[model samples]
Target: MTTLQVEGLTKVFGRGAGRTVAVQPMDLEIDTSTALGIVGESGSGKSTLARLLVGFETPTAGAIHLDGRPISRMLSMPRERREFRRAVQFVAQDTFSAFDPRRTLRDAVATPLRVLREVTGPAADAEIRDVLGLLQLDPALLDRYPSQVSGGQRQRFALARSLVVRPQILLCDEVVSALDVSVQGAVLNMIRDYCETYRVGLGFISHGLPATTFIADTLLVMRHGAVVETGPTEQVVDRPEHPYTRTLLDAYRRGPRRVVAVDPVA
Candidate 1:
């Protein structure tokens, strides 16, 4: 029953003539077991929104609440801030930059456990193995560095690093965009499985609507910095109200057999 809410969130960069509104005023909420999909072409504000939710980016004007408790107060308090960070996790698309080439994946995954959760020694080792097993990854892969694994493996490892934290809400930004069609499908299915199994709220961000269709319970479509459409996944995909949404559905219909391999990064 953990709920994360954001209201009137806005982000503006630069000033005057060079100013750019990365995100417009917006509101969104997600709780445990709710899968919310956010889709838009490249340059859309979905990524910015994700950053804002996770506190990686500060909002120009807005408020965030966790279970009706303002994030402002939670963040201001040291112990609450630490706890709040653990409740939300972000998995990024770029795996190449996430880990150190010299260290084993095991060490990388174990850092957060030791630092944030204060889990170490045998407890941390068991936790790492358990999370990896859930991802269907072998414990053997932990010995390998980031360079040694395939893109799909590296991506899953990135996710495992976050899942090791056992977050209540998980946000992924294009975690499957770089994989092959087959690999992408497996990763997407894995995403669905892990989130559901853990009862975690999911904020899935992607450029293609088709990618979100099978996984999202609620879909929010964005154009530029504005939300063009938002509703149950079936309604938005089937009876698209906006012209831009229709265009997305049309593109999906006309796409090739590997339909999920759509990255309209416009």
Candidate 2:
């Protein structure tokens, strides 16, 4: 089985008095068919961790391994880099901004296939259609530009774009935070189904505990760039050990149904 492992992963910025530790040394492992959620409030470094895993940012002090092979080494070589990209895909929160406003959804989805030289002509068209279909998006929308669709549709299209590449791991960073509550629930369901059907390992980064609990089998809670708790979702949510974890759970229980902020008092 494919496994993505991180050991002593860390990221720091600036120097001396100005230095800020964005992500402290942390370790994690994700295997195929499993979903791991990283949840925390703003400035907790959840997004930074996702960036490091997807190669958007290089690690300051650690190693990322895929099935025992170093990802850093894989990223250094042109051929291996392409392979790595195919193996791991990222879905960002700003779905509209992620796509070119001028391009049709089909064009946006087809870009990766063209860059990777993976498919062509009718085959590529078929692949794009198939993946978009999986997301329950209408085929007619394929001809529309990003600006022509609703935010929810645009986000689903973003997911379609990633799925078209047939990635083994899906790294999502606050993917549903921008949508309406109803739309968020729909999108979350679609993501869960897609991951299960494809047996893709999911690294879901979100500030929303409710959404994370809905989608992830395991939870990794963060606070100020450090892991405050890690365990099965139920245990962490229902029987939290860390004070921070309990605070988060309490907030979710007491706050508005859709929000996921931490409570001032636990």
Candidate number of the best TM-score: 2
RMSD of each: 3.9, 5.1
Q: What TM-score would candidate 1 get against the native? A: 0.93
User: Which ten-residue region of model 1 has the weakest summed lDDT?
Assistant: 257-266
lDDT of each: 0.85, 0.87
TM-score of each: 0.93, 0.94
TM-score between model 2 and native: 0.94
Model 1 Cα lDDT, one tens digit per residue, 112-228: 778779899999999999988766688898898989988888998899999888899999999888887767877777778888987999999998766688678999998888888
Write model 2 residue lDDT over 4-110, tens digit each, in one string: 89999999988999998999999999888779999999999999999899888899999999889899999999998898898889999987679998889889989
